[model samples]
Target: MKQAVVGYKVQNLLNFLVENPQLKDEVIGISEPLAATQTEFVMRRRRSLQDEDAITVYLLGMEGTVAPLPLVSQVLQWQAENIKAFVHSHFPGDADLCGIIGRASQCLPPLRKALNATQVDKDEVLSLFIDHIDALESAKVPYPSYYSELLEMVLEDGFTSEVLHSKLFQDAAISIKEWGSPRQQQTFVAICSICPTATARMLLRYCSYDDLSPYVFDYFDQRSVGSMIEPHTYLTIRRRLEKSLSRISSEINVVFITDSSNGAVAANASGAADATFFSVRPFNKPVTLDTLFVLDAATISSFHQLRGGGVSYPLLCAEARECNSRRAASNEKRKTLPQGAVV
Candidate 1:
């Protein structure tokens, strides 16, 4: 609910880790495979959703499309009707959306590791919703339309608090408003709280959630959330992460965490099988090694160049400058002096 679904904390470490030159390549090595795999996965998914002919047509329409991240980030935010809303706001014709999707197809890999490690409170929250709905039903006096309407709407379309606010609620509200186990708004809020999980389910309904859901069942359900990373890619990614952590001899500490839906990760200043890193397991079990790779990917974040306002260490800069100047002078003198002449 709080974006634990995105592994917000894992992202913080990854952001910092990518900064060091020594570790950057390895970081890419670990993450790139996963990203590449995601790209293929997205492509295959799009093909399934639309068609290859449609995809080709879209590609033909685009001549020069700018980066997709700006557009894709915008796309990712809409709670419902994302593509529909995005097309209206961002594109004039098919070209831009095609281009953006093309770009997104490639780019959504970087942030995925965090998503793979995602843990959500959906089931817990779902249980809470059930309890409230049950309470509301228990206190209600038998009415022909009230329970039928709620149950029909909840089961048919899915649970949403909108039903309580809609015209459908007019009769029910009038009759049930006085019962007050929970006010209509409170009961509705509890129902709507499952929206995030439902949204996640809708997003991942098709693909790899089947194998991975058991690993992180609470965060994932029948609807879908995160899928398992490709096995080879996932294993390679773990190795690369470990490699980067090993090579970078800095004060920075990295804790690799993986979370399953109901899983609990044990960590606390632990190391990489030693005393440097905290091995995180997000599920209740200790199947950190056996479970699917929990590293989720997302749209890639580009490695940034140094910012303009950075202040140099003046003393160190001056010292290095002087040393370089002295070496240059000595080199020039040696060049000027005759070969084998001692002065």
Candidate 2:
């Protein structure tokens, strides 16, 4: 009965090859001797042996052909352990592996477990993971969450792939929550920081001042050589730090500057007093509009000197206007006088 069943299967296979002339030509083109191969098309199984054997035979017959594209999805539908050997053995080329790796989310759970159990196909699978990391980073995969297990595998192997590090940096920049757990975030940071410049710049670009300030300081103190950073990156970080400090200062302290004699209030960017000019006195409480008066010449001159060319004249009262008039007259007289004459 078993011999008749084997003969029947062989006859059906011959009939299939005859019906498909292209597949027949491919089978004839096989250069490698199938008899010398270590793994057989059949394996010992407890049940459904016929079904398993059929899948193996079908996969082997379709080897070295364009049919693996559609065949891969079918093989992926089966148990990973059941079909992984055929996948690694028959579809060992780059194109085939890439196609399978692109659907990593669909097959990674079981196939990853199977691959992790054996050292034989680990390198090939890891290479695919490193090469096509972008595919894993895309929307198809849920990013760090889905790949956390794979990350553990890579970490265990003591291997670093630059692109994987870049992806982790990008994911962390988007949201630290993308790493799922606090432990994962810490782990990712440890790995991602290997590419320090790229990781630091990405965090600087996307993270809030409160979120990234400590990292920047830590990078400078611990990681940066001689505390040196790129000019643009350094300036950007400094500006953010200054702005953050200014916000905190404004919240904690309130100082209103007013002219001692006329009580003219000077408007500054922040409520904190300008310690540079000593003519005005700072009050803790808000000054009423009734106490408002125009700024004097000394105060205007002091404010302009401190603020540079773009000083606003909102507080310029009658006294300031007259001072401007005198300054204009002096400029006109100087233009009319001889080159060496003093105004």
Candidate 3:
């Protein structure tokens, strides 16, 4: 008898939510379930259902007030297929509710399985995955694994610039960066490399110093110097890097350069007369650029002296010369090689 009562109550609540559209919206939007009961729509519903039964009366009270996540979870439990159908029927042309339902029902594997088994459209599935990705955090799903897996799944059919700029993709990238998994890092690079122009545009708009720095480094690492060898690609990447470096803190003078061996380097300049060099490289390869280096405030002063045929900063000047000479030697070596010979 107790099992039957509980089951009836669950069904009653589900029916109530379905029948009362405004009340359902309020319930989903409300952060606290109890808060939703105070809303005008829910209060009106309570008055109408006042004399229905003990179960109906209790549900119309705080008993029926369920937070969005738990409510969707309950709904999913009662009828897995109904969740999607419920969205289409009750919340027609409503993106907000779609996102809410998607997010709330995401942690239920059975629902996802049912959706897949029934051959749901790929676009709908992608939207569902994006919405529910955060649900994993609360569900204690293995985050990094799921993150990469979902990314690969979404990109299986290829993605557009629009997809890259979506809140879902951008947020996922930020989360991946925070996780700092090497495998995921490479995945990030590969995704960005597919459409370098779009990636650059997105970085310029959405990415901060922390995000852009690592992406730039990782991109070169994965794609190697050969990928950006095109004049347009090189300029696009260079301009973006310059923008990022320019926005860094004034106190920390960083010199961005590509070495003779095609390695990208960022050296932090200290207060000393000669800027202390440090190597921060994404990969080791033959990275070359016409304008090979960006000297910050500290090194720029000495760089000016070197340009005027004076060697006020011997260390920095010598290093610059060494880099140029090595590059020239590499070019000359290539020239001496027979046609089609690998250097």
Candidate 4:
């Protein structure tokens, strides 16, 4: 009769043998929730049994998600004891497991030590896992029932790839390209890619010249060099536009602004400031003054007379500049009283 041989992808090797008699000399399993010491034991065991027969090999789980550290540790530890070798899987595309494995690798020194120990041997453990998974897939073994769910979790939570590719982000990018300046577009893209959705929104909503200047300034002071303006800066600029309009005009029935890219910045002014002036300052550029003008219901109605009813940034900039020039000339005229001499 063949010697009863039980193989496990992970050890506590003796425990597995004690639990199942049929698995005796035939049982093979892999480790789970891999840690440092366990991985060494596995590697060692496999090396010692290189010449052994009647040993079965087992590869547990799918590729990418395979627990490597403990498995490697176990193999290393058992090499001295002479255990047979078995293949293992690594689910590389699985983000959750990859993150877990990454974190584990960082936090556990023992695992790293074991991996370094094999440096002289030039064994590529990760490559081995990948090869094993490929071989298993080619062999047409049935996948586990939970495989899809595990993959989904990894994609959604472990990595941000799904969120970055989401429709919301794509739409925002498209809008920015269409209406925002190049700087604005780049800033928006960076925010969408790097920030959590809620945080990004908050940054846009709060950081502005009028509402939170001090806070915004402080934030910039602390950021990494060359980082783009935070969302809060955009929000502050929007609020400043709203407040400036309120102070300058009374006919402005409503005032609102949006990212043009994000379609998110929106506000309405009523009551005394029913008619309003709105302006947008593209990132890294001075505000366009020629475009500023009073907006009223009648003005909006007149705008509708044109092919497209939306307000135009270029038109607003022109009007704002003209208005400022007239104001400055008026101030000059007032100061002309001194030309007579002293009084």
Residues 42-93 of candidate 1: C-alpha lDDT, one tens digit per residue = 3332333222221010000000011111111211233222223333333324
Residue 86 of model 4 has an lDDT of: 17
- On a 0 to 100 scale, what is the lDDT of residue 147 in model 3? 40
Q: Taking the tens digit of each residue's C-alpha lDDT, what string does model 4 give over 277-311?
A: 11121111111122111121111111111122232
Could you tell me the lDDT of residue 316 within candidate 4? 27
TM-score of each: 0.19, 0.17, 0.18, 0.19
Q: Write the per-residue lDDT of candidate 3 for residues 70-181, one digit (tens) a residue.
A: 2212222222222333334334245654444444456657446645555666456545644465454345323333343333322321223221211212222343343334
Candidate 2 ranges beyond 4 A from true positions: 1-107, 110-114, 138-142, 145-343
Instruction: Single out the weakest 10-residue window by summed lDDT for candidate 4.
Output: 59-68
User: Candidate 3 — which residues are off by over 4 angstroms?
Assistant: 1-226, 231-234, 245-343
Worst 10 residues of 2 by lDDT: 55-64
Best of the two (1, 2) by lDDT: 2
Task: Give the count of colliding residue pairs in each prediction.
Answer: 23, 0, 4, 75
Worst 10 residues of 1 by lDDT: 55-64
lDDT, candidate 2, 150-181, per-residue tens: 33332222113221111111112232232213
Cα deviation in Å at residue 81, candidate 1? Answer: 2.6
Off by over 4 Å in 1: 1-80, 93-98, 101-235, 243-247, 250-254, 257-343
